[model samples]
Target: MLLSDARSIGRVALPLYLSMVAVSLGALVNTAALGRYGTEALAAFAVTTAVYFPATAAVAGAVRGVMPFVAAKADDPPELLRVVRNGTWLAVFVGVPAALAVAGAGVIARAGGVPAATVAQLGPFPLLMAAAMLVGGFGSTATSCLVGLGRSKVVMRAGLAGAASTAVLSPLLVWKLGLNGAGIALCTANLVSCLITVSGLRGRLPGRLGRTIHFGQIRELAKVGIPMAGTVLVKFAVLGVLTVAAARVSTTAVAAHNIATGLAGLTFTAAVAIGQAVVPLVSTRTEGVRRAVIAGLTITVATLAAICAVIVLGGAERLFTDDPEVRAAVAGLLALLVVVVLADGLQAVLGFGLAGLKRTTPSFVIFSGCYGVLAVIAVPAAQHGLTGLWAALAAANLAVAVGQGLAFRRASNL
Candidate 1:
């Protein structure tokens, strides 16, 4: 049973992982393109991205809530079409407000004490990214439905197309129109990807579109989606607080923290892929979540181990920056990340499994209530500086992992 579960997960996870890597690489390409414009440009890009990603994640997560529903009805073509149509409407409902909110990025950045010149250079970036997110939200709905239907190849292909377009367009746009061009490139890629994915869905499903707007289905989606969005928002809040804490330590600490975070994010891609795979399987199959969770943990640990090994053996510090202080700080943070990643990986699988079972509220409440409150306290209370911040983060992740695991066990009666 364990072996069977592992194979089943791998079949979905491998393609998802590749797609995720492509997406991450696309972001890197954008950053690299902006980096060519100098420090202020890079800083502006970073600020906008920090402001933009959480808003998009919230909407995208909510739209992705359609996955389990679609997976449960995978064998029913009409039901899948209805759900997909409703999911698209839900995305628009959530996305418009999100886009409007993110349009205030300049105001937020100014209030956050970003330099006026950088803020000025950041003009239209927020709006451009907001547009991208709106389009990407629709694409997320399509991708989720496809994944739930066990058609991850479509998602993978769309992601690859987006990544390829971003890689080519970002640098060209940045070269032509400066920092704002990156935003344009992003929007272009997102729109292209959305078109491709939606087209794929049409080809696969082969049916007329259902009602464009369905309040009942929208409400049902929101019932599952709101908590899912809350989960993402809580996690983002924790990271934001931690970033603030690290900033207070010093500029060097902030640089180190970012590098470590980037590396940790790469490792987390595997965990997320595993979690995504687990969702559709758990939604369709009965039992085996225990084995699935264990398998996910094993994969996460092994991936992190390889990353840690490379950091130690391959002088991974040079890959990020050349500063000695930053390198030293990143090394210390990576040590703490060994614990953080494990906890996060465990929680992800359990959380997604519970999400599959439509038992997301418990996971949301426990994560936000426990991790959120502790992270708020731990960041400010950590007297030992950056180490204290890392400790706080690790503790928060551990609490959530344990809490979510217990919650899932009780909910599942396993």
Candidate 2:
């Protein structure tokens, strides 16, 4: 049964994994390109990304909460169509506020105590990314619906298209326009991806187009999604706070932190692919929770272990930047990521498993409480320097992973 479950998950996860890798590569390329401009530009990009990702996560997470519901009715074409329609509405509902929040990036950066010079260099970068978020939210909804319907290949293709566009356009824009060029490239790529994914959905699931927004369905989605959104928001908010603390330290620390984070994101996406694979299987199969969780953990452990080995053996620091100081700093942070990535992988699988069961509130509560405590500890730790900050983050991931693992055990038993 375990082997069978693993195979099933692998089938779904492989394309998703490749797609995520492509997207992560695009981010890595962006970071590398931005690094050429200067440390100030890199730091500004990091700060803006820290702010932008959380807001987008909140909106995306809420819309993704529709997946389990959609999967449960996968055999019913009409019902699935209705769920997709309502989920689109939910995307718009959450995305507007998130876009507004992102538009105020300059104010937020200042309040976070980012250096004035870095802030000045940021320009219209934040506003452009905010627009991307609005379009990306719809893309996320369509992608989640396809995942729920076991059509992950469509999502994979869309992600690849976006990544390719970003990879080609970001450097050109940055070379021509500086920091703002990166933003323009991101917005254009997001719009293109959203159109592709949504169009694919229209082709695959043609149906009546005149249904009005159903508050009952919206409420149903929110009942599950709001907690999921809260979970995602809490996790990213912790990182945002840490980014602010890093800014307080020095531009060098911020640059090192972003580089390490970009590397860690590659491993994190592998975990996400496994979790996403588990979601539909858990929703559709009876008595599948235990096997699904085990498969997810197994794949996550293997994937991250391989990544850690490469980083340790290959001296992968040169892939991002050439600065001796930044490379040295990244080395220490990478050591911490060896543990953090495993813990993060475990928590992602467990949290998504709980969501598949429609038991998302526990994840929200556990992550919020664990990360809140980490936030309090991180402020003083940042004063000590970058190593201290990395240690604090590592501890936070461990705590959340343990908490969510235990919660999953209890939820599965129920």
- The clash count for each model shown is 0, 0
lDDT of 2 by residue, 68-172 (tens): 988897788878778888999999899988998888887888997888987887788888988998998999899888888777888889889989999999899
lDDT (Cα, 0-100) at 366 in candidate 1? 89
lDDT of candidate 1 over 133-197, digit per residue (tens): 88998898888887787778888888899999999999999999888899999999898888988
lDDT (0 to 1) per candidate: 0.82, 0.85
Query: TM-score of model 2 relative to the true fold?
Result: 0.88
Off by over 4 Å in 1: none
Model 1 TM-score (2 dp): 0.94
Report the poorest 10 consecutive residues by lDDT, candidate 1.
Answer: 374-383
